[model samples]
Target chain A: MKVLVAVKRVIDYNVKIRVKADQSDVDLTNVKMAMNPFCEIAIEEAVRLKEKGIATEVVAVSIGPKAAQEQLRTALALGADCAIHIETDERAESLAVAKLLAKVVEEEQPGLVILGKQAIDTDNNQTGQMLAALTNLPQGTFASEVVVDGDKVNVTREIDGGLQTIALTLPAIVTADLRLNEPRYAKLPDIMKAKKKPLDVKTPADYGVEIASKVSLLKVESPAERKGGIKVASVDELIDKLKNEAKVL
Target chain B: MSILALADLHEGQLAGATARVVAAAQAIGGDIDVLVVGEGVHAAAEAAAKLDGVSKVRVADNAVYAHQLAEPMGALLVELADGYTHVLASASTTGKNVLPRLAALKDVSQLSDVIAVESADTFKRPIYAGNAIATVKSDEALKVITVRTTGFDAVSDGNSAPIEVVDTVVENNQSSFVKEELAKSDRPELGGAKMVISGGRGMGNGDNFKLLDGIADKLGAAIGASRAAVDAGFVPNDMQVGQTGKIVAPDLYIAVGISGAIQHLAGMKDSKVIVAINKDEEAPIFQVADYGLVGDLFEILPELESKL
Candidate 1:
């Protein structure tokens, strides 16, 4: 079976994001960039499927600025056989990205598609499901556990409720949840090998897909800083403060 | 201008988030029409009709909408949204699943999880897990948005509006619904609960969650856990309350032994009142908390339960 995984480049999870001075966008000048952590998990899952002999080929795809090619290369190093970089300087929203991915899906008819539940930067958990809807495929989103049988894939999803186990037919889309698997660090040898791997480039226009903006960002601002509260001495004082001052008890 | 809102219903009742989305729709200009699609969902449709600021309730009753799967729903919404300028839904699992599909199918960009409506075409949303807020303006012909229900008040109950039956069905038999293995919990649901009591890795064992039951019951709160507690196998993923987990804005949020990681704070910082109980005085939770109790939760929880 063929598996396609979508990866994204975003600010590293550890770096605290800062709003730009003008509050129009995030300040990205000095921030450390890395592949989205959940996307890394998706890459790890696809590599595992190939290692288990269940998948014949794994292709990693990224739609972002040219710098996002670094994320595709990282995916290749992590174990994706080939990579596709849809170069665009536009900061595409989830719907636009999903449209681009759906165009790719039509060109490359992979039986299974794996992607992160959402990107850390946008946090719009939409692409995988949108792709599934566009292609008329089943979607098992926020999957913590995925098991493949002959033609059926049983996915245990992490939803608002507890775990929900859904059995989908072949040719489905699954988004990786946090607890899905721990992604591995790319070894130096693999990184060197990834340089030699096949990397294909495309554009959103190549697929005749138009990214229409529905929401325009007015400003980006830091969240309201929480003020520090006075520390109480005794449990009784805490109770008194809660009742008299806070009135939240 | 009239805004069309989609009501996400499971079984036969309005999801709690639907009212919040209605409230968001009311914040923006115009008459609101709510659409309820599902088989045997008349009860839900009727319930949605009762929400304030709703001018009309459209019910699309069909067997294909049994699961109200994203594909069919997207197609239906596309057909129904031809005249409406704005389409809104709660940013719940259902809304997140369906609206993006509609946007992609319609070749329109979708704004996910808006926290505030600045105007008809502009909104504010949390980008980096509530670390930063982005105010956006849309120039698209049609605006597709999912409202972060926690950021808005739910429409008050009263005044049932007229219900309109929309006879629209789009057939795309691409997927089948398999049986679901839903994990049942005796406690209230995390997102819908009025109060929440969450524990972190400091809770120690899986069984230690029982100690929280007394206080939770006293406060009528749902039980939640931090990612650390969930990763430690002390609780299920559904119990997780954080950036990557469920975002809850309850009346009161009691964080027990939780050292307020930024991710954890993202989910519950919108709570009306926050109280932290931890041994570490330097824990980050104290910063956002309205009340702080520096003590071991294991002892304080029981004592607090007795006192309550």
Candidate 2:
């Protein structure tokens, strides 16, 4: 079986983000960028499947600007055998991204597709399921554990209340949740080998999917600031404040 | 334009998030029709009919809808989606589970977890765990979306509308309903809680999470954990509140011992009031906090409990 993993490049998880002056977008200039952390887990799950012989090949694909090649290379170093780069500078919505990925799945015909439940950047958490929907394939979303037996894939999803185990057919899409697995760091030797990994570049139009956006962004203002409250000296004082000042109780 | 809003029901009652999704539909400037699907959900459908701006409430009651397995629910939504330009649900487990399948069945893509509707086709969503925001436009004739309830207020109940009971035939036996392991907690549901108290890796061990119990109990707050705490196996995956986890907007959110990562903040930054208690004065959580208490959580939490 073959597995396809989708990765995305985004602002580093450590950096503080600022809204642009126009309140229309994030200030990406000079920001530290890295592979989305959850995508790394997706790639890790795909690579681990390959290691366990559940998958014969693992291909990593990314949809972003040319700088996204760095993330694709990161996935390759982590064990994806080859990489596909769909070059686009525009910020694609989850639906458009899923449409593009669905086309790629049609062309590649991978048995299993893995994606992060949500990118650290957008946190939309829609693309993988959307891709699954577009392809008419079964989906195992927010997977904490995955077990493949013959033609069935048992996926343990991390739900808000608790855990749910769903069995899906092969040729399924699975979105990796946190705690699925810790991604491995690429060893120095693998980094050198990743340079030789085959990386294919394509355009959104190449897949016959229009990248036209439908949503209009009116503004991108900073989230409201929290007002600091005084630390009450005692529980009784806090209660008094809650009942009198805050009136939340 | 007409929009379809799936009213989420749990135990024959309307889920509060359903009202929030209806509010989002109102923002899109369209006539709203709500679908209440569950077993014996007539009461819930009637409740939905009372919400302001809801023109109609379509009820799909069946045993299959009780568990809300995505396969049948998606089919039902797709069937009801005819002639509607937009379909929306709350970004809850049920909504997330069913909407994408509906989108795919309709051959359209779904916009997931939209924080705000920019236009009929455009949306503002947090990307990269709220570290960055992306504005996306969908061109599909029928757009499917999941609204972040935190970004919108729940629909009020004043206007009364007619409740339309629509029967659905659930096809597709390819998928079977499996057993679920829902975490039993007395605490309020995390997504809807007004106050949240979250522990972090600094809590030391799974047992140490008990330290947060008294504070949470006093505040009637939902208990949450950082990804680090979840990673350390100190708590269940559902307790995780971060970019990749559950995004919440509570009136007051308190972080205990959490060295805030950007991923962790994205999920909770929309909170109205943020309080951070950490031993390290330089913890990044303080940057976003409305109230910062620089001290060890072990010491501070007890004091906080007693003070409350």
Taken over the whole model, the C-alpha lDDT of each candidate is 0.86, 0.83
lDDT of 1 by residue, B1-308 (tens): 77999997744578878888899998888989999998899999989988888899999999888776666788899899988989999887778878887776776778888999888888998988999998888887888899988889888879689999999887855545655555576667788888899999889888998999998988888999999999999988888898888899988898998999989999999888888888999999999988888888778888888887
Consecutive 10-residue window with the lowest summed lDDT within model 1 chain A: A158-167
Docking class of 1: medium
TM-score, structure 1 vs. true = 0.95
Error of 1 at A35 (Å): 0.6
- What DockQ would you assign to candidate 1? 0.66
lDDT minimum window of 10 residues, candidate 2 chain B: B170-179
| Cα lDDT of model 2 by residue, B1-308, tens digit | 89999987654688888888988998898899999887888899888988999998899888777667666787788788999999999888778877877876676767778888767888877654565566777778998888888999987889788887787777655455566788888888898899999999999999999998998898899999998998888998889897767889898888888998877887898887677778887788888876677766777777778777
Q: Extract clashing residue pairs from model 1.
A: A23-A220, A216-B137, A217-B136, A218-B135, A218-B136
lDDT of each residue in A32-105, candidate 2, tens digit only: 99998889999999999999989999999999899999999999999999999999998787778899899989
